[model samples]
Target: MYLPPHFKIDELAAIHAAMQGSRLATLVTATTDGLIGTPLPLILDPREGDYGTLYGHVARPNPQWKLPPTGEAMAIFTGPDAYVTPSWYATKAEHGKVVPTWNYLAVHAYGAVEFFEDADRLLDVVTRLTDLHERSRAEAWQVSDAPADFIRAQLRGIVGLKMPITRLDAKKKMSQNRKAEDRAGVIAGLGASDDPVDREVAAMIPME
Candidate 1:
């Protein structure tokens, strides 16, 4: 994460918000063979430790879990993102110096990963993850809804993951580097975009 001073997000609470707002995260680890990445959902327990601990799981047969990690693992959480066109910048008309760029928010967490197969821990992680994703549904489902035997059988196919985050790096590039007029133009352009993500990024841009 090459973070310029203007684009850096140094506040812990803001970083946590970006991390929590993201549902899917990319877990990357270095290995003797090469680098491996897995797309998965993680639950952050901020109270678990100094920085925080992440809880998730991978399929038992997934080679990522079985492969030994060479060093630290990085979990990447990406929030709202959109493409900013040069047409959206006031500078384009001033001197034709504007170009397209991406505006986005992201958080990276680094830590040592612990993989476990304990039934109790696996059940807890699965249950919590399920609840988090299902809470917005009209008919929220729970692990208890399934038969014990079936749930147990399913749990056998997965391994739990726990990473106590040692450090966090967060960045939000929302036209903060541009002039106020250019930023306002970007907001208007993005707010009128066809993509919902563009509108989301527009909403996140500071107006001042």
Candidate 2:
């Protein structure tokens, strides 16, 4: 994350919000073989530690859980992102120096990777993750909705993950580096875009 000073997101609340809203994350670890990465949905538990811990599980057969990570692992969470065209910048007309860029938010969490297969811990992680994602639905599903035997059987196929985040690097690049007129132009252009993500990105751009 090569973030310039103007593009950095220092607010912990803002970073946490982005992390919580992201369902999928990329987990990276350095191993003797090389850098191994896994894309999965992680559950963030702020109560677990100072910076919060990530919880998830990988298929029991997935080699990532079996790898020996030499140091801390990294979990990446990406938020709303959109392509910004040069035509959207007021500077393009003023100085013809504008270029395309991306407006997005992301968080990188680093910590020791811990793997476990205990039934109790696995159940706890799965139940909490399910509840977190299902709470907003009208007919929310639950682990209890299925038979205990079936759920137990399913749990056996996966191993749990617990990463206590030791470092957090967050970035929110929303035209903060551009001039006010250029930023306003970008917002207007993005707000009218065909992609819903562009509209969301437009709304996130801070008013200068």
User: Which is the leading candidate under lDDT?
Assistant: 1
Q: In terms of TM-score, which candidate is strongest?
A: 1
Model 2 TM: 0.97
- Please give, for residues 74-161, the per-residue lDDT of candidate 2 as tens digits: 9999999999899988778888987899889999999999999999999999999899989999999999999999999999999999
lDDT for each candidate structure: 0.94, 0.92
**On a 0 to 100 scale, what is the lDDT of residue 42 in model 2?**
96
Query: What's the lDDT of the predicted structure labeled candidate 2?
Result: 0.92
Clashes of each: 0, 0
Kindly give the stretch of ten consecutive residues in candidate 2 with the minimal lDDT sum: 7-16
lDDT of 1 by residue, 39-116 (tens): 999999988888889999999988998889999999999998998999989899999987899999999999999999
User: If scored against the real structure, what TM-score would every candidate get?
Assistant: 0.98, 0.97
Model 1 per-residue lDDT at 108: 94
